[model samples]
Target chain A: EAGVAQSPRYKIIEKRQSVAFWCNPISGHATLYWYQQILGQGPKLLIQFQNNGVVDDSQLPKDRFSAERLKGVDSTLKIQPAKLEDSAVYLCASELSGANVLTFGAGSRLTVL
Target chain B: AQSVAQPEDQVNVAEGNPLTVKCTYSVSGNPYLFWYVQYPNRGLQFLLKYITGDNLVKGSYGFEAEFNKSQTSFHLKKPSALVSDSALYFCAVRAAPGGRRALTFGSGTRLQVQP
Candidate 1:
């Protein structure tokens, strides 16, 4: 089976700029997640979508970040006015509804100058 | 809320020697524990998970994790380490069956298998 797919393997922008990353989850997976992994730290959940409806976004920095999974199969995460601290790898993961295991994508690396 | 801890920042072992990476978790309900490996510049790859049934769960690349409920630990183990095993390992947990389902991960432990 194809694993989750992410676009723009790398991105670089200045602080206060805007950037967006795309993700395509595995076929038929009903649950998708976005996570930010800072250097020397574990991945932290940014948002979660269950078939287009948000299941969680409490951890997301709403002031500067926004995400949407329009059709429930693919997602996009945008960070406007990117902060220097926003430089990290953006990871996309997916799972079968009610399943325990999750498959992750290669991730999009962002660097804010 | 659920939380995970990887007490070691890194673990070093010689090739062909046994290796172990420690992990502990806290959750309000029955916990689902998982281990994942991340190569440089890559996303996390699932190693194994402990949902139920067995306390010892075997996973990819000859890795296994023992779930000790009393200790609230899930430690990854391998009988023989290989140079290729050197990478970052993360421990994650989420409450089983209820509440929020997203996993909470630990800071991660880097494993260095010397050849």
Candidate 2:
């Protein structure tokens, strides 16, 4: 019955620095997702995973961003050489199966200087 | 490509009055529509969804949305607004073509309810 959990609710880093965000989804959930929400904008899908396998990541910035759900229960999203444009809130969500409703975490707000 | 549009950037309504936030979508085939709400500094929460049923769908927090296939619109509505209803609302859609499940979201609409 626990909700999705995320670590480091807020983060600050300099441009070109690296940052990582972690997410622990609801127990028994089979699908997980990562999204980025810029100020005044809706959350954009970054990646999605069904269990330990990726379902979609077409929108992700392959050159700078990467994510993994090794055991399928927890996930980590990383951004290397962060840019000012990368300043946004990163949200983590989980669902019971494909196309099911999502339950989200508080999200990690990143500020890149 | 599937996409959603929220025409209004913000809407202000007095408490106890009716409220509406407009949204339109573009997709290839039948669409799975959704509405979500976000509090400041928080993640998005599902309000309701329209898959297949009546044109009017009711959701949490006394909210409802009318799905119009002819207009390709799904506008969020509430008969009586409350101050606690103030938040950012987003409309989203997913095309059923090829069985893709990813959602395309609108920029968002900010709702302000005055007492």
Candidate 3:
């Protein structure tokens, strides 16, 4: 089976610019998650979706960040007016369900100047 | 709130030697623990997890972790270290009683296995 796929392995943008990353999860997976991993730190959950419905997004920065999993197969995470602090790797992962193991994508590395 | 801590910033071990990376967690009620490994330029990979059974759980890539409820720790261990095992290791935990399934992760420990 194919693994989770992400686009634009790396990206660079100036502060205040807008950027977006895309993710295509593994086939048949029912749950998808987006996480932000800063350098030297673990990945932090940004949002989670269970088949097109959001399961949790309490940690997401509503003012600057937003994500959507339309139709439950693919997802996109966007950050508007990016800041230096937003520089980090964005990872996408998928699982069959709540109890299943998550498989991750290589991640999209975003560098905000 | 649930959280995890990796006390060691980095660990160095020669090939064939034993390796240990310390981890501790804080959460309400029972805890679900997990260990993940990340290679350079790659995403995190699931190494193993402890749900509700034995305190000792064996995981992928010849790794294991011991859950000590009394100490609130779940340290990852390997009997023999391989140079290929060098990578960033993260420990995570989730609250058991709550219906929430999100994982709270530690900062991460870099393991360097020398040849």
Candidate 4:
């Protein structure tokens, strides 16, 4: 019963540069999600995936942010040409069932200069 | 249109004393409410949830939340606070049973427990 896994506990990027974060949800979990948590703010949903297909990504910045869960297992969230405001923590979560509480990863902290 | 609000940005309490963190929400139909605790540099951990049945739902770490339908509020509570209870608390909500899967979270309330 391992928890959701995420990589690169911390990252630093310059404005206009690109950065990517990865996530591995718990085994047997059917849903995966990516959320952005800015300092002093709640985590905002960026994208959600049910299996290998996307369930919702309406809040995602299409022009700069993109995410995908290939084969319905691993996920990657990318931000192209990052902005200073993009400095925040990226969290990955998994849900065994939509009716249950989510299990979250440690998160990847991004500091954009 | 589901949303949660944590009016207080921070709350302070002394060890061995009771503690309460307030939260309110708005959503259509039945609401699935939840409380989560986040330690610094870590992700959120589920504390409790209110789906149905009892209005007072207990959760991990000696935490509990009372769900009031009329008030549309789910406030976290602990009978006796501990210094380890200090952390960031978030209130979240979503439509229960056959609704959006995404959770709407509050800005969060920082709990500081003084020993």
Candidate 5:
């Protein structure tokens, strides 16, 4: 069984520039999530998708961040006009419906200079 | 609203010694709690979860957590520590009743087991 897969393990961008991170969850997983982990902090859920339909995005900054799951399999998180504080690791996790176990990806670390 | 707290920023223990990492949570009604460990430059690995029935739950890597409803705490423990066990540990809780399934996590605690 393969774990969740994420791409571009590392990224560096300038402030105000736009950046995007990609995530491909485990096959057959019904729930996908995007999280932001700042240094010394636990990952915070940025958004969640249940089969291509957003389940939660209350913490997402609408003005600068957006995410979507295509066909409920792969997902992408984008940040436009990035801020220095946005520098963090973007983690992707997936779980089956009604299951509590969550499988995570290695994450993409973003450095905004 | 749901939240978890790891009061300690770091915990140190010698190899072969018993270890404990503290965690507390705040949520309305029943709480679904979890523990995850992250090694350097690695994604979080699920350690264990407490949904119902048992206050003591054992998980991967010889880890266990005891859910104390009265104290609203779930502390991770291991009988014998190993150098390889050094990592960042996070505690998380599911959202409130009828809310999204997204988890709210603690700031994280770094555990260092010395050899």
Candidate 6:
């Protein structure tokens, strides 16, 4: 089985600029997640989707960060007016519904100047 | 709310020596504990998890973790450390069987194994 796929392995942008990262989850997986990992810290859940409907987005900064998993397959995370604090690695993971383990993508590293 | 703690920022051990990475967690309900390893510029790889059954769970890459309910801890252990095992280890927890099921991860502990 193929692992989760992410695009633009790296990205750099000035503060207040906009950026978007894409993710393709493993085949047949029904649950998808987006996490933000800051330097020297662990990954923090940004949003979660069960199929195409959102299950959680409590931690996502709705004012700047938004994510959508359309058609219940691929996902896109966008950060508009990116802030310095937004510079971090964005990871996408997927797992079968009711499964305990999650398979992750290599991740997209973003640098906000 | 669910949370995890990795008291040590880093752990150093010589190759072929026993190694341990401590992790403690708190959750509102029964806990689902997990350990993940992350290499440079890569995503986190599942190491092991404690869902139920045995208190000790074995996982990929010769790693294991003991789930202590009373202590609220799940510590990763390897009998003999390998240089290749050097990486960032993260402990994560989530409440069992309810809610959103999103994991809350610790800050992470970097393990350095020297030959």
Best DockQ goes to which candidate? 6
TM-score (0 to 1) of chain B for each candidate = 0.97, 0.96, 0.97, 0.97, 0.95, 0.97
Write the number of the candidate with greater TM-score, choosing between 3 and 5. 5
> Which scores greater on DockQ, model 5 or model 6?
6
Q: Each prediction's DockQ? A: 0.71, 0.59, 0.65, 0.67, 0.69, 0.71
lDDT of 4 by residue, B4-91 (tens): 9999999999999999999999998999999999998788999889989999999998999999999999999999999999999999
The reply for model 3, stretches above 4 Å from the true place, is: B97-99
Model 5: per-residue Cα lDDT at residue A87: 97
Candidate 3 local lDDT, A1-113, one digit each (tens): 99999988999999999999999999988889899999999999999898899999999999999999878898999999899999999999998765647889999999999
TM-score of each: 0.98, 0.96, 0.96, 0.98, 0.97, 0.98
Q: Give each candidate's interface RMSD in Å.
A: 1.8, 2.4, 2.0, 1.8, 2.1, 1.6
Q: What is the lDDT of residue A109 in candidate 6?
A: 98
The lDDT of each candidate is 0.94, 0.92, 0.92, 0.92, 0.92, 0.94
Superposed Cα RMSD, model 1? 1.0
How far residue A97's Cα lies from its native spot in candidate 1, in Å, is: 1.1
Interface RMSD of 2: 2.4
DockQ, structure candidate 5: 0.69
Residue-level lDDT tens digits of model 5 in A10-93: 999999999999999999998999999999888999999999999889999999999999798999999999999999999999
Question: In model 1, which runs have C-alpha deviations exceeding 4 angstroms?
Answer: B98-100
Q: How good is chain A of candidate 4, measured by TM-score?
A: 0.97
Show model 4 residue runs off by greater than 4 Å.
B98-100
Task: Estimate, for each residue in B1-115, the C-alpha lDDT of model 2 and write its tens digit.
Answer: 8899999999999999999999999998898899999998778999999888799999999999999999999999999999999999999998763233667789999999999
Candidate 5 deviant stretches above 4 angstroms: B95-100
RMSD versus native structure for model 5: 1.4
For residue B74, give model 1's deviation from the true position in Å: 0.4
